[model samples]
Target: MGQRTVIPFGPQHPVLPEPVHLDLIIEDEKVIEAIPQLGFVHRGLEKLVQKKDYTAFVAVTERICGICSFGHSLGYSQTIEVLMSIEVPRRAEFLRVIWHELSRVHSHLLWLGLLADGFGYENLFMQCWRLRERVLDIFEATTGGRVILSACNVGGVNQDIFDEDLRGIVRVLDGMRGEFGELSKTFFRDRSVQNRLGGVGYLSKEEAQDLCIVGPFARASGVEEDIRSYGYGGYSALASFEPITSKRGDGYARCEVRAREVLQSMDIIAELVDKIPDTPLMTSVKGAPGADSIAVSRLEQPRGECFYYAKGNGTKYLERFRIRTPTSQNIAGMTKTLQGCDLADVPLNVLTIDPCISCTER
Candidate 1:
């Protein structure tokens, strides 16, 4: 047998912003197997459901991850709506869709920057983040918070977009479309990026499906299971909406899938703004009494499909709240992809899974 060396990749690595430890076993330059250690950032947020009122619990859900904050809150709200059988106003749903897609764009741009940084492309990283700043500015203007929007509520949204603000958002997204197209072209077509990412850390479609990967990870492997297809929020009315999928299942494929999604999200937002129906933004939600009714709700967050389970026990406080984020589901597939990869490709492979540790631990 050849000599094998064990190496610890992270709990606090420069490449990863989140804390995820990987114990890698390698022979020379090729990784043989990887053991992942999670729970470093576990905050026990799930246990808080019993202590906090249903309304206040939204804040806890939003804290799952700074990047996917809106998605978490929206999923939480949707779950509660299911439990209460409340039909959110059409306008509120549209607004929620707008914020959700904006959050998606922002999150994807942030990931693009991080991926660029991982590859030592400092200028590309900076450019991606500069574009992300525009999305953050829009979030602050509409929701009063840059990272955590806190705009979603149980029955509806807390804020409404004025006609002027709507037009401004459209203009910003239109401009961003051109910028994103250029950036994506450069990133995808550039020889250096292609050489580094193409055919690296490949996950076959069968492997991805067998392991049950989620979000862009699964989409890259030709899975078409986007929760948006369920017609929740305003997605049902989206005329040109289609979930992006690729069969290559490599790092390059994951990047391409995300880039395509960014464009699709922008298109959805534009359609939403154009079809804005005049209606009240919120509705009063009253408690429904039963023997702790539970409901499941799922949404296609930028990271992938997020699952929320909520149980109400005829009280202000929820009896139980469980959230299963996409990252949690993708962990297994990530470990599988790490096999036979070089140590240098680990970061990109891990990131291709988009490991949102906070969401997983919560």
Candidate 2:
């Protein structure tokens, strides 16, 4: 047997994107187990609902994680909309979905860049980020902010994208699609990449379901789970919708699923932008939620399913607010995959799950 030692992998690491810490038990060069250390960046954002009114708290929810910001605001607003029985306009729904899918594209691209960097491919990393900037430009044109748009409100969106601009957005994405397709070749065909991730961190469908994994991680394992298919928001208006999935259930499969999802998001955006109705953007909200009222909403974020829960007591301020981020749900699976992995490949395995430590801590 190899000599045993304990290694700590970042709340800070050169290659890790999020501030995630793992206590790894090593038997020689192989990982025997990995234990997650949480709350490194917790800020008590959920408790802020007590001080912020239901309408005002939309901003707070959006701040949960910059990458998943739109989904947070959308889900929190949806929960409040449910609590108050507010029916948002059809146009608003479509706009919300457009922004949400764009956010997903940005997130997946950023992740792809980080993944490339993890493999020491500096040029590829920069190329991935360069493509991501175009998505950010679209956000800046539509909502006036690159990261935190703060466009979603309790009843609907705060503003609308002009029809011309929406079409322009589609054109820009069409231009980028070809570029991204060329870049993805490295991830799929490169011998180095395949050796690094192809068969690493294999998780069977049963194990994924057993761990209650969500998002690309679960989909890669053949779980066939995606919250968007439920057709919430503008998704209901789409011609057809299906979850992107793979049965490989390995590190490469996870990468493949997310890479494909980036294209899927672009298509969803194109559909919503084309079909969006001509209606009012914002619907005025009045009165607080009913006393002792509770409502919940789930959104399929870039990484996976994010759940928001809210409770009200006949007041503007929510009595309780909570969020169960995808990272939180997938942490167990991360540790599970860590078992029996080579120490050098730990980062690749961890990145495949796309751990959002900030979201999880929040």
Candidate 3:
């Protein structure tokens, strides 16, 4: 073997969205081993539960990640609802699902843009973000905030959209769908994109499962596990919903999974709007959770399955709160994908997993 050399991969990079450092060991221009260093921007958001109380903490959870902000808020609220035995109303559930799916579409669009930029496809990158702005506009129109939406609460959603607004949302999605097709064609058929993504960063199904990878990473590897299938937030109403998967388990497979998921999200939003009941947007949640009660909730976020745990001691405050983001769980898989790849492709493999360092460190 050639003499090994160590090189730091991140904490700051042109393509990465958040700060995550990697100590890469390379020999003759190929990575021999890869190690990750986290906590560069650890915000300790979970610890704020002790000071904010259960009802007030929903706002804090929404700030954990901008791309998946609504998902985090929904997860935290659902956990509290479970602990307090509050039954969320049917209409609220449907509305929550609508917002959650919109968030997913926004996140995937952002990822697709980043992926295009990673391989120097700057035109495609610009096209993807340009389309993504329509999704953000829908968010701002409904929730009054494009990124950090404070729309979910412990019992239900904080706001409601009229039937007219829902119809407008569908129109926006229709326009987006048309524009997205033109952009995605470049991702699927362009020679340059295929050359950079196809057959690169391969991960076997067994390796993905062993690493406990979640979200699109696991699905792209054919794991067939999507937490949305468990039926939280009106997902159960869509009986035919199935997790998207590809057996190839490579960078191309990952990109395909996310691309298809964006289309699927549009379908889901339309279905929810059609079936949404005309009832109150939120239910009253009273009293604190029972003493020593513990609740755990899982939801399929844009990145992957996000797990939330909340414990109560019958006081005004929560005893403990914990979050396990998908990026944190996929670090092992990241290391596996890094080995034996060219040094230049390191960022491509890393971005393919769609790492959200803020979510991981929070």
Candidate 4:
């Protein structure tokens, strides 16, 4: 029997962008167990709902994670809308979904680039980020901020994208489709990429359900669970929605699902702008939420299912606000996947779940 050793993986590492620290217990070259350490970057932002009024906290939620900025803001606003019974206009709802899906596209692209980098595919990494830049350009042109777009509010959006600009966004995504297709081919068919990732970290469908995994991570494990499938909000307006799933349950499957999701999100954005109605962007918000009123909302973030909760005290600020990010939910599944894997494959296996420590610990 090989001697076991304990190796601390990160709060800082070259491979992972987030400050996720893991104590990997390994025997020889195989990992036997992994213990995660979190809360290093906890900022106590959730408690700020007390200081920041209900409406003002939209910006605060937007800052939860740069990649999922629009999703966080949208989820928080949707929660407040339910609490206050705010009927967002149809046009606003469509716009919300458009921006939210765009966030998903860019986020997946960012993850794809990181995955490529993790595999030492430098050129592929640059190409992925270059395409991601186009999505950011769309955000910059519309919301004026590439990353932390402060566009969402409780009732609706702060900015209304005109039909002309919406068409422009579609055109841009359309143009990127061909290039993205080529990238997908490389990710799927490249011998090196396949050899590096294929069958590396396996999570069976039953295991995924047992762990209650969310988003593409679960989808990769063949669990057909997507918040969008329920058709909430503007998603109801979509022609059809089904989560992109792969039954392989490996690192390759994870990459494949995310790569495919970028394409799916682009199509969703196109549908949204096509059906977007011309109406008022923002609804007038009046009166505070009912005393002790609580509302919860769920969103399919880039990582997985994000949960938002808000409790109102019939005052300007919410009595309490909480967000359960997907990464936190998937952390257990991540550790479970680490057992019996090669020590060297740890980073790529961890990246497959796409951890966002900022959102998870906030």
Q: What is the lDDT of residue 263 in candidate 2?
A: 95
State the lDDT of candidate 3 residue by residue for 152-243, as single tens digits.
Answer: 99898889999999988988998889889988898999988999998778999999999999999999999999998888868978857889
**Which residue ranges in model 3 land beyond 4 Å of their true spot?**
none
lDDT of 1 by residue, 117-165 (tens): 8888999999999999999999999989999889999899999999789
Clashing pairs in 1: none
RMSD in Å for all candidates:
1.1, 0.9, 0.9, 0.8
Task: State which candidate, 1 or 3, has the greater TM-score.
Answer: 3
- List per-prediction Cα lDDT, in the order shown: 0.88, 0.91, 0.91, 0.92
Please identify model 4 stretches exceeding 4 Å from their true place: none
| Model 3 lowest lDDT segment of ten | 231-240
Candidate 3 lDDT at 204 equals 95
Q: Which 10-residue span in candidate 1 carries the lowest summed lDDT?
A: 283-292
User: How many residue pairs collide in each prediction?
Assistant: 0, 0, 1, 0
